[model samples]
Target: MESIVSELEGTLVKDSDPFSYYMLVAFEASGIIRFALLLMLWPVTRLLDACGMGDCGLKLTIFVATAGLRVSEIESVARAVLPKFYMDDIDMEAWRVFSSCDKRVVVTKTPRVMVERFVKEHLRADEVIGSELVHDRQLVRPLPVIFHDGRLVKRPTPSTAILILLWIPFGITLAIIRIAIGVMLPMWAVPKLSRLFGGKVIVKGKPPPPTSGSGVLFVCTHRTLMDPVVLSSVLQRKIPAIKSELSNGDLVVCPEGTTCREPFLLRFSALFAELTDRIVPVAMNYRVGFFHATTARGWKGLDPIFFFMNPRPVYEVTFLNQLPHEATCSSGKSPHDVANYVQRILAATLGFECTNFTRKDKYRVLAGNDGIVSYTSSVGRIKKLVTGFKKVVSTFKPFIQ
Candidate 1:
């Protein structure tokens, strides 16, 4: 067999610098606290790399990123988040040569988990020789990454890291001010007052005409937690927050169930379609200079705070035409069909692609488990600890004897 051997970092992938990659792992898998710790030690890692101890620096960086993290969490990030970034950095010429081989093997100093999935699945390599064991982008993933977790939407290079650290104080203050303005002022005055505080809400396409009887479901693209609030301000009326009791008055809902930063829309829940025939598809998008308001692994409560921390946070609300009576579930259409139709309409208006991916897919990829959190009993935990201890003691019996 004609076998091709290649290095992953610089041969197939153009940029060998792993700082940004490690930063991504640290932030996504662990949290901002871990990311901050890694950043604080970055200078030392860089110095080691510059002084002929590049491998040592790489080890140090990996240690910081993966230390104390569960294997599953790190693997989840490796499988989901890193591939997107890695594929973007692939060298076209190198890939051409690599793909032409009958038998392909790739080598990388990076941990096997990080590249294995990308290499074997995306690159179709026969074997991967890394520090541990196995391999693995395309803009189109071998596996789609519908869900990912992290607040830093932008890649964190050294400069970006420094800027984020510096901006935290100002960001916190600005977040508080933005929150205060929204809470204290009337909906009609929010857009006006927000401008003075560096907040921008651009409204396009007037709201759909009101309908009589039963509440109208405002189906919106999930951009951030602030979607309903922004829409409410634009409509100059209170739009009830999500996951609330449905009332006779109109309501807002993001069928996606999670915030998606990309221009693609996740599958809408059919439950919204069954809720009412009066549906107004809203295309919502946002722009932030420094931070994103969405996260998968991090605390979601802080999303609003991070969103307001940007220098000027912008939200564009485009209200599309209301769904016709014949196009809804009331007209004998399946709930799924109506939901998909509305999804396509909103995607077209925003110039985004419609995806069948949903919230469960998002959590499963970004996090190791399904989105549900199961609490273990304290007694069950102690039993597990005792069982583990017995196994360890049994293994040491020979040595002790």
Candidate 2:
């Protein structure tokens, strides 16, 4: 708050009777307040600060470059610093006025990733311009790996473990109920569940039916942990893999291994070629959320579902032409070539840059992990007494939050 007050005070260079001048003032004031609140609440900022990044820190440098360190420099800095989580925790209350505003809405934000296609999400918005700050052109910040959402069986604290155990029957029961309804009446139930959970799915072009009996592989770009649910509801089918041979119906598959914020697409896995000829490449974008889940398929446990169910997520999907499935293309292309060709198609369709780096690379860099399970690691469990039956507390700090 002191920072906000000082920033505004420092920037007052001139006073004019023009209406535009006051409006400019208002915009600067609004942007600073919003960004100040955003910075204070962001866990990542706190984490970075804890790592000895005080005023002369990496984040402060980026923030100053994007926004301004001094009041006189604020407007010149130009872009607003939006935390990565804006999509997941959207405040509709804050956006309501903008949704209905008649004036030209220009969203200038930082970290180039945040503003990608954000203009398309709001129909009434006029323009948006974004910027990015990179350490040698790559915005890779080192992060620590946590066991929170990666594996099928997460090692939880005693309290959360008990809560999960208690919720098992409920989760199973809910899963069964939803599955029965979805499988029996996907055409009807999926849309209903989607709306019930505050999700919107937009599709482009005519695509094969989800119920098309036979082998069909649905491929698309990734965005957010909520994707599996949105994709499941949008396609009206679960894309789960099975060794039981899915020679029968349509099965959807996400091409990019995990949700990504980078403009580039991760390496392609030729899984579609291994399946039947009905390989459909799709382009996907999301209106909200940035926390990309790093765990592999079938590894994430139920608690991960908690984020998807948090309310307000939107998915936009565009299906492209089916890839050539011939053993040899007309140009004598192998299956590997065919896979790359499909990746190109998907990239061109969605405006994503194609890259060879795996999602694990992002996980390792972003999570500050060695990317290998620590074997032969042991811990001594120490507990503190609790008043009443409240539960025990551990004195040891977690590796990562």
Candidate 3:
């Protein structure tokens, strides 16, 4: 069998900038605290790299990013998030040659776990030789990463890193102020008050008047966590619009179940279609300069914080005609048919492409797990951490003795 030996990073990827991937692992696996620690140590890493000790710098970064994270958590990021970024950075010329070979081996100085999955899965390498994450050993995609979680949209190069380092303090203050305004003021008063802080909500197309008897189901295109909030601000009505529940007042549901940043609609779940025949399709979109309002891999609690932190965030809400009695599930249309019909209507209104991809597909590609949020009690997590720490301490005791 013809075998080929190759290197990763510069050899396979067009750009060798590893900071962004490291930033991702730091932010997704751990949290902002870890991410800040890594960013603070960037100067040290750069200094070490400049002194011709790049491997030392790499090791330092790996420890900062991966420390305290579970093996599974790190693996989740590698499997879901990193692959997309790596695939985007692949050097076409290098890939052409690498793929032509029958057997493939990849080598790199990066921690083996980081590159091994990307190498074997996407690059189809037979073996990866690289630096082991813990010991010393050996190491490693072109897939459009459609979904990813993080506040930062741009890759964290040295310059970007510096900007983020400077922005955090200001961002937090801005987020708090923005959140306070939303909380303190009424929905009708919010849009007006928001402008003082660089928030803008543009309303278009007259919203259908609220139906009198049965509750109306507002089917909205999911753009950000703020979709419903923004929609509510424009609505000006105080009628209760809860998620999933069909109230006598009104109900709001995003059938996509997850946010899609791009101008494409994930498959609409059919449950909303069967909820009620009184359906109103809502098209929503938003723009932000420095931060996004949605994530697939990171702590979702921060979605609104990052959203409100944007210096000038703009949201546009368009309301379309209500679904007629003939077009709803109540009129003998299958639930799936009604769902697809609403999806197409919203996609058309927003100029987005309708896709059959659902929430599971999004999370599977971006987070390496199902999109469901699992709750592990804080006590449970503390116990797990203590157990793992004891194992590590015991393992090193032999060397110390």
Which structure among the candidates has the greatest lDDT?
Answer: 1
Work out the TM-score per prediction: 0.81, 0.45, 0.76
lDDT, residue 67, candidate 3: 80
lDDT of 2 at 261: 54
Per-residue lDDT over 1-401 for candidate 2, one digit per residue giving the tens place of the 0 to 100 score: 01111111112111111122112222233443433333333445446668875433434434433353354223221212111222223344444434444433333323333332223232223343335322112121222111122221221222333444455455545545443444455354666775654556787867776554565666767665444455555665455433133466655566666656545677777665666666777777765332222332122343234333323445677877766546324446655676787778878877777877665555443332333541111001101111211121011001000
Query: What are the lDDT scores of the predictions, listed in order?
Result: 0.76, 0.43, 0.74
Return the number of clashes found in candidate 2. 8
Q: Encode model 1's per-residue lDDT on 108-161: one tens digit a residue.
A: 888888888778767778788887644222222234344545667667888888
Give lDDT for model 1. Answer: 0.76
Give stretches of model 1 more than 4 Å off: 1-3, 29-37, 96-102, 135-144, 209-215, 241-247, 369-401
Q: Of the pair 1 and 3, which is ahead by lDDT?
A: 1
Model 1 TM-score, all chains together: 0.81
lDDT of 3 by residue, 301-356 (tens): 55777888887889999988889999997789999999989999899988988887
